[model samples]
Target chain A: MSVSVAQTALLDKEPQFRHAIPTRDGRTARNRARYTFTVLAFLLPSAIPLLLFVLGPMVAAAWVSLHKWNLLAPMQWVGLGNYAKLLTDPITGDVFVHTIYYIAGYLPLVYFGGLALALALNTALKGRSILRGIYFLPVVTSWIVVALVWRWLLSPTSGIVNTVLAAVGIHGPGWWTDPHWAMPAIIVASSWKDLGFVMVILLAGLQAIPTELYDASKVDGAGWWRRLFSVTLPLLSPSTFFVIVISLINGFQVFDQVYAMTGGGPNGASEVVVQQIYDLTFRYGRAGEASALSWMLFAVVLAVTVIQVRGQRRWVTYG
Target chain B: MAEALLTARTPARRTVGRAPRSREAKLRLAGVIVLHLVIIVGAIAMFFPFLWTIITSITPGASLTTTPALIPKNPSLGAYQRLFVERPFGQVILNSFLLAVITTAVQLVTSSTAAYAFSRLPFRGQNVVFGVYLATMMIPLQVLIVPLFVELKAFGLLDTYLGALLPTFATAFGIFLLRQAINQVPRELDEAATIDGAGHFRIFTGIILPNIRPAIATLVVFAFMGSWNSFLWPLVVLRSPELQTLPIALAGLQGQYTSQWDVIMAGSVVSVLPMLALYVFAQKYVIQGVASSGIK
Candidate 1:
């Protein structure tokens, strides 16, 4: 019996197959426990950690949203005060507005920048690999560093960007200081750092396209612009859709760049929701409001992602 | 096939007729050159910040962040010295490195197995479980800050290393990536291992681990990079000066008006150097992962 059992195990060693037996038997009961235990092996250390650290914190923030709690004081049951404050509070409104403005400029710059870069490099050219390294450098560089360099570059008087502009007899705005240009400058800086990332995604989409399609188009006497419009654009939608979904999610959570570049400053024209949450929770110890704001962002991101995913099925082409 | 290939691309290669070597050939060459040059220049524009950081870190305080000091007037290790003497900058680096290593190690192990289960093995609520995992990715991490803080307080994990790594240790992205990678791995490999009477754990650890080495490396570098670059989570979790990670410490430093530019640059260099080295080593995989992982 032992030999036969061992041989049977050897015959079908896959875990899923081993557990695919249909029965009301004792062996099946034991297999159930073993399967559950095996599943827990993966969950115990990894998923649970995120569940605790990432997911748990999100849920706690929501719970805190219902209260009037701060770091200094005990939680007070001021149910829904934080959420209510979100609608009526002028400061919250300002932060929300600035967050959208930053997104408005930053997203287009990054998305288009990535797409153009991907297209430019798609041709069979010498040193394409080297071009990739150069393009992707900023995506890996720390935000602290990018922000620092930009801080210098955008410095009004002696900064290189303005210095170059002055050469053309046009003065660049005091980027970090002027309320009008502070957020825009931050967007430009952020876009510079993020362009490579988008390029890589769009590039992957570019590479995934079939060479035969291009040949077929060429056979039919299609030109560069025509080939791009009919073949490349349609085929590249999946990658672009993926990039858009991610960039938008990341757009809502813009913090480090803003923290380093603008400090949400020059009359708070760049104050984002995450920055606001950071101030409320860390600076002011207002955990409730921070959690409330976080929940709001989560909802917005969730809805956006779902809508995008559903919308993607109709438009995005996959091979 | 090999012997025949040695004689290929002979007279038969010319069947397409004389290639257009007129205006079109020259035009194509010119276009490629101009296009590639634009990409190269844009690449420089993006990467200039990293070079600037490295250069500035070694420079002294003179003409830093002022006067078009593109190059230091007199470069010095003066910033490095100031970094250590001025504050607990070394502690911040140590904390970030230590936390990143620990978090990444746990995430890799857990995410791999879970991903294996999702991709290879069927269980109750399998689809639902996977959906739940993907669905959770959209939940703004900031949402759980309040609850996690409270939970940490209950366990006295707040302001501790474990607290910092706990929430990030099991990540959805890790699972998602591992699942995709594992799914691509031939099921025959698993079947062969299992047919040898190996238990599920043994099969995964033995056959799966060895085969998925490249995928694992990809995950490791990414997990390390993300955790290392993580700021907001550590900021919310740890408040003590000695406990803060690199970004948190840098933020604290910059939060105070009149931040010493030299020392901050030094700290920034410290935070970025390890990842830079890792990138230099695994440039291909890291770059690919960064570009693709934008799915958030």
Candidate 2:
């Protein structure tokens, strides 16, 4: 009797289908077919493009990496020749080293700068919104514009930075013009542009932390420094981990700024992985080698991301 | 329990707050001032380059050999005029605007549909398909430029806007964001619509779209900004000067006008102003989106 009542209720609920309701197995089969068709229909617009452009090209990249073909020439089956060349090339090694150097400098500076901004602005202060806006302005600006502005600002002789430094009775380096200073200059510009993005993410994390925890810590006779170290940093570790991963990924792919500001100049001091790939493909016409180097970069980025994900277990804390 | 906890904590707080109220207020005021001062300095540091760019752009005859005055004695729009009249900048700006708009619109439609499918429609291999989309997000554009360029060439799309727009149409990030939003819309809404004999299209258009307005707005801003500020792909694909986008044009100007700081700065200002305007209007959406997703 209960089963009959439930059946009636279901029939009443789906009134439009009451008269046409088929056998259970037949209905289920028809519904499944309908669902499959609808899913395909909905997915078609994006799937076509993703498959044609993104997914297809990814496979093509791997296939191309194993062969040699310039734009106008016939293809040659290279079967790891490009990989052998890329692995042995001293310039490829230098490019990787430079990319690492950039990450080494950029990761710390951007992370700390962003952290400080996030911490400070997380407080209750008048016009903090405006301050956040100012800090984040560069993140929205195109890298090309930022790079050009920085190149002009660090113009060695007549730039404002050096002018201000000279006012304090200090000499300034040639910045982008100086080989030793080129990567540093790029790092500075990059960090300045990116710190705001980091701050926004970290600020969200900061706001997510429960105030009750702070209250409890205070009730336990903990000082501000102790609370910060034991409570704040530990609780903030997940956001910190995220920021580091993003910064590391971006730092490895540093291109537009390097391309515009220094052009990997001052005798190849700032030649990075992407810039090198671009040069090899477009400039030197070593299409196979360029494809191979890009794959190498892919490997490195993947390895780094995997390691971070695995390493987060030791450091990251969850509430 | 709350009263007990408050009272228990009051004694410790009172000891720490033993100083006179007025004195403590004064100290707090001092702290606020110091905080403001530090932030203002940092703000200035962040804003100075923009300020300097504007100053140089208006200062006629500004050069790299000598610094222009902080406050220009005679500000002029000569450099901006030169950008439009003497160069192909007018067309370039238009191209960037057009491409950004079309890209944003296409992405909104594609991402929303795909998001709906992933959220509501269960198919065989659904998880695997979704996983493929997520994994693709890890492979940066630099990794696929070579093959993409060749593929475009095969289709006779190189150096065209089609080539540039095709690769950016379906972004994994957009789909992820929209799917998250679609999931939050109560399933009952769709079920009710279904009971009312509403088809999937009608339900999607009437229920889901209306419910996820904020997510749509966020996607619009990101897609527009991503297309507008894109440099690398356009740089690789576009060869004709007439087809140049803003970043490529700006880079070209930088290389061509090695010492003409005024004109280069002018281009920089022009390129940045639209972004600044969009940012001001959409600051909340942009900030909230970034905070939530950590997307750059």
Put down candidate 1 lDDT per residue, A1-319, tens digits, no spaces: 2333222322332334333332446566777777778777766666666565665666666677898887677888878888888878888888878887988898899999888777765544456556666676676677766876788888888788999999999978988999998988999988888887777666655644545566666567666666667777766765677578668877888888888788889788888888888888778888788888887777777777777756765665433
TM-score of every candidate relative to the true structure: 0.75, 0.75
Off-target runs (Cα >4 Å) in candidate 2 are A1-45, A122-124, A151-174, A177-180, A200-243, A309-319, B1-21, B86-91, B109-143, B153-160, B173-219, B235-244, B252-259, B285-296
DockQ for all candidate structures vs. native = 0.31, 0.31
Q: A23-59, model 2: which lDDT tens digit per residue?
A: 4554787776776778789999999999999889878
* Colliding pairs, model 2: none
The candidate that wins on DockQ is 2
* lDDT for each residue of candidate 2 in B185-254, tens digit (9 for 90 to 100): 5466677888999988998998888666656765676688899989879998999888899988887887
Task: Give the Å shift of residue B26 in candidate 2.
Answer: 3.1
TM-score of chain B of 2: 0.76
Q: How close is candidate 1 to the true structure, as a TM-score?
A: 0.75
Give the DockQ-based CAPRI class for model 1.
acceptable
